[model samples]
Target: MNLSFSKLFFVLAFVFGLFAVMVIAKSVLIPLSMALLVSFILFPVVQKLEAWGVNRLLAAFLSLLMMFLILTGFLTLFSTQIMNFSDQIAGFTGKIMDTLSEVIVYINGNINFIEDLNREELIEEGISWLQASSGTLLQSTFSTTATLFTGIFTTIIFTFLILIYRDGLTKAFVSFGEVENQDRIFRMLQKIQRVGKQYLSGMFILILILGFANSIGLLLIGIDNPFLFGFLAALLSIVPFVGTTIGAVIPVLYAFMSSDSLWVPVAVVIWFWAIQVIESNFLNPKIVGSSLNVNALVAILSLLVGAAVWGVAGMILFLPFASILKVICEEFDQLKPIAMLISNDISGDEKKAAKNSMWIEKVKGWFK
Candidate 1:
């Protein structure tokens, strides 16, 4: 009992210690991690340019420039939509408040078990509170926007430098391992980069498909700015489990606030739920593939722990790294079990089938 407890205590201590370090260094680490993952996606572009006889410096510059342009395009689209719709959104305030007041009044009238509730008084209190805090809210929004832009700039700079020195970085990492194990370490790095590249590329394609699908559905439902809202929801889907619901909620709330009929919001909800079903079962597996192969429990745990350690950036970054961690763990006997634990748990028959599979080893050999 004592021995088992001792081992467990040390393991927990190590985990907590890592978390403490992550939290303390998050401001630096978040941008660096973002840059690293992005570089993985961009690495192939850089390589292709060089192979085609482009200057090394020019190749890197062009790759970064392309990335910058793409990102700028997305931001411009979102900002334009938000700017144009801001007034319309404000116009919904009265309608939403009135609807809420009606609901509360109906509840108070019907639910005799509860005391009489003054919906008007409650609405007045809420409006007054908002008025009082408007300045603070504006200040918070400004600060958050500034922080976001600053982080983006830092990540871009880091990504450029990483692309310029990727080879050196790979060598440095390999050198940290024993000479006999150096090749294995290099292979692991390649695997990580491959997984990162494939995952990001797949996510981009999936988002495009989803955005188009959502827009078509929303347009059929007679929603205005369907494309804008569709792409917004699609972008949110990048963050995995929590993001999907949030993506759905914004449009659904807009439907409720803007339409008199409950069915509009209900239709929005049903559409998103159907998208989720199709996305999970068909689109994601086909596009994203099972490269990450993280189990639900581990994926959710990673998101929670990452969010605690590094906020939204952590939530976005950690899942792919968890996949990378599984790769690293697979290189060692002691850690292979952990890799399995992180992976999607399979039934015995499935496991047997995987063990019997020959192509996996063949693919790994090609990399070697």
Candidate 2:
């Protein structure tokens, strides 16, 4: 009875802790999480430099410098395009309204399966809603901007410290164990490093390939500011499910508005679809397969939960953290069940066994 009560209390405490985390995510957790993620991503690069006979501090500095330069270059190149895009949003909004109106008219005229749809009122309501929430939206935007800067500052500091003392950190973990357990801990650390590095590197490669492909495709289709649109798509590709659609929408909408050609957007869609198909089936399997091993459902759910707790930054950091958690769980025998649930490693035999078990259970229940 005491043991059971203790277990119940532990579970309740865990739930309460999770609730507290969700409530204070932005102020307390987000910056630290972002920092850890950035550090993990950059750790491999620093190690490579160290292998090349560079001092750890200098290697980390160089790696961080390269990252900063790349970020600055991207920002410099894209700033003007972003400003122009922002300026054109009002025009885009008008065009969208016009397009919606045309669609409603077409639908009303053709699909008369007892058409009682109040399309005009719906559109008006949407416009009204946008206007009504404009102030709150602006306030939210500024607040987010402030939070972003703070997170960036904290992340930079954390990443630098982590990189500088990565070896020490590993040794510290090892020190917590007996000599035999020290080896195990060291091996786990190495595995974590390998997995984290591979995941980040694979993602970077995928992003670049997709970005370049998008830019070239957009240029071929005569889309203005193809590079900008492509870069936007590439960045959004960091987000699952919605990234490709969001990326495709801008170019397609621009094509519609600029050339007034429906075929252009349709062609662009086809091109994006082809690219996505290739990436999913071929490139992703070759590059990222079996490394993170997170199931699609779990990834999506984690992303949603992260977003709800912290927003876009949460979505970006959630997957890698989840992958790390899975790795940690897998490393310990007691936590293997949790690891299995997190992993995408359901063998055919296991699947068949599970199916048969389900069927047997159902048969027994029916008989009873």
- Evaluated with TM-score, which candidate comes out highest? 1
Estimated TM-score per prediction? 0.88, 0.78
Off by over 4 Å in 1: 1-10, 77-80, 107-123, 345-368
Q: Residue 65: error of model 1 in Å?
A: 1.2
Leading candidate by lDDT = 1
TM-score of 2: 0.78
- Predicted candidate 2 versus true structure: per-residue lDDT over 183-249, tens digit per residue: 8888887777777778777878888898899999989998877889987887787776667678778
Quote model 1's TM-score: 0.88
lDDT of 2: 0.78
Clashes of 1: 0
C-alpha lDDT values of all predictions: 0.85, 0.78
User: Model 1: which ten-residue window has the lowest total lDDT?
Assistant: 359-368
